[model samples]
Target: MALFLNTPKLNYWIPKLIEESEEELILIVPYIQTSKNVLNALNKADSNGVEITLVYRENKLSDYEKSKLLALKNINLLHHPNVHCKCYYNGDLLIVGSMNLYEYSEKNNREMGILMNRIRFKGQETFASRMVNDRTDVFDDAILEIREIINAASLEKASKKAKQTAFKIDIIKTEEDIVRDRCDRLNISFLNKKFRTVEYLDNKWFAQCENFFDKVDVVFQTHRIEITFRLEQNELYNLYRAWMQTYDLYEFHGFKYYWNKPDQELLVYKHDNFDWSTDNADCNKDKKYYEGLSTIIKKYRKITNK
Candidate 1:
């Protein structure tokens, strides 16, 4: 059987579906803004001991929205980075169409939805089991990684450029060296210059030595690290582009690039767009060049221990 409903008309069937659902409710929506109807439906489902899983895009959630969603015990608000489909699956029943959860989509915009009560399955297993098996945790570690990138981007946007170069550099001769000889050199230089202590993070030793190691500034990838200092806006961009050229790094598509003037920090990242072509020699050359360039920066920036 087929059923049709408009936005204002959703209230009629929505509550009925929630009341009848016994196993699970899977909601797939592209965008979710704050709305009373959506929240109320979710709350009702939660109170009924239904396992609610919402898959939506990973846009920044407002403080209010975060707080409201956090209060719900059973609601699972997940990030679906590639989610573009809109549908509702309640056990064996599947509703597919263009209708969104928003009031406008429901009440004003032209919308349509299909309600399928009995689905035919190709295998011996039931249709509900198949649908559940297709379910994925679209909001786990990937979301956390994306959040870290977003946080770093925010910091990059707010920092001011240094009036003078304040970055410390380090260099090592061999690729297998455990200790950062470059940082050791930087420590001596920093002591002589009396620059404030900056934390350093190192990968080779898997160690974070503070004050003892001249309080190394943040430790980073064994191959790449970032140091922030003040520079003119144009100078900063020039330096960044020069740095990129030092490695001949080609720009990745869809990556968001940002620079903070006050902090003199530049960040270029779009984890999703990164494509390291293992098959393409040119890409490898480009990658090697960039790695070499980072090595060069570390070599010169370090205050030589000798």
Candidate 2:
């Protein structure tokens, strides 16, 4: 038996549809300006872990409305541009209607709907495969159609939480991002290269070269960068010999050989500054050339025996 409903009945029964659901619910609404009672019922269903799938046309929604619905925890919301049919199902009952699940339609418009029992086969009445216009519009068929609609849509911002995943939207790069980028520009083996921070008194950034005692560390002071390295005395002489053969000590920043009496340690320092933005070409010469200071360091850092 099919029950015909006027606007007042639609207003009452839609929330009832959400309330009466035990296992699953599916709603396909084209313009979803759902009433407060309707939203409340859906929220209740979501809190109870009722599996729900909702399909609607995004072009008809306000920005706030779209965000409010997308914030729900358990409802799988989707968009389909070609759908205007309004369907509400709660496993056992199905309502197909001219009503849009819109508050204005329920309060003012002369809307109408038809509710029927969704039985697969009961005493020869097969509501699941109901015959209409020489075709079967099965209750299960709409479920499949909703699934297809979901599959066709991109899910990047579909919910920000389609499956309870944390999403980061900060596109701007940080100081750490810049440091890592410079490390990448160095001509070194990517698998063996690594960089990190040293948080002692003043925080500093350091890059490891193939797991050796000597490391390239950068200290950003105001706008100036103080590049430092620690190595043995013999390693410094070995590097300086090869470096002078091609370039001068000016390009080595301020490299020196500690030869006072019997000093043991070799420490190198270079002070410079540049535009720290993503314009890496201005900051560091990524290409092999006699262009930036970084290129000079990259060429000579590996020439030593240690």
Candidate 3:
């Protein structure tokens, strides 16, 4: 059993534990916005058929985030509102810490924690079982119920509604028409779309998209126009790292990344502040905003694809 304290070790240790896993990978972080490399490692574990279970706080995850996580395979995602413990474990190791999966902690925060090798604890085999089979509180149960609803509903319906609401003007036929036409003109594959509003089904919606390198989506709302990259796991970390090295981070004001693992979004918004309430919104006026975003998306796609 070894302990890692304030050593920027999780970036190395977490992935190492994931890489060494043979059966399952469990991560329990209250808040998350992990780096791309770490996300890639998690995705790789999933691709290899590792049963990945994530226990996180529901309050911190957005609907867009919930939808993306529900899209993955061989993973069990549980949300507990009051959960603040950060515990990570696989078949052979257990890591618990003050660190979150958030990029801020991994990259910038002075966080501290401990990593224990389970094998060294020999006769105390119940340690892993206890961590895995821990009991859930009432909040956890409530989140599970909500999660079932979000995961079951298709994202297409949400996208259609967003399109209807955003492009309700007679000039547009359907949301799909605009998105499809734009994709066709750009020679990009139409993947999936996602939508969320404070009012709808606990603010959850999902859409299906093609598996392409281009993963960003143009999210149109009454008060804001956002170009968001919906990434699964480590793609954001990898891409963000590259973007930071190449682009001037300070210049892209509202452009940043957020992750809760399995559900990550890298986004830039036309407006930093938003009045998300329905009464304060005017989707009709955002035509020019959307056009500007389309141009940005096109350029971003080219840069990332290259």
Give lDDT per model, in order.
0.44, 0.56, 0.51
Which 10-residue span in candidate 2 carries the lowest summed lDDT?
166-175
Clashes of each: 33, 0, 12
lDDT string, candidate 3, 151-235, tens digits: 4423322223234454121111123333344433233222133232222133222222232226655544322333456665576
Give the poorly placed runs of model 1, Cα more than 4 Å off: 119-306
TM-scores of the candidates are 0.36, 0.44, 0.39
Task: Compose the digit string of candidate 1's lDDT tens values, residues 259-285.
Answer: 444345434342334554442453443
lDDT (10s digit) by residue, model 2, range 131-167: 3311123444654655565566434243324345432
How many pairs of residues in model 2 come into backbone collision?
Answer: 0
Per TM-score, the best of the predicted structures is 2
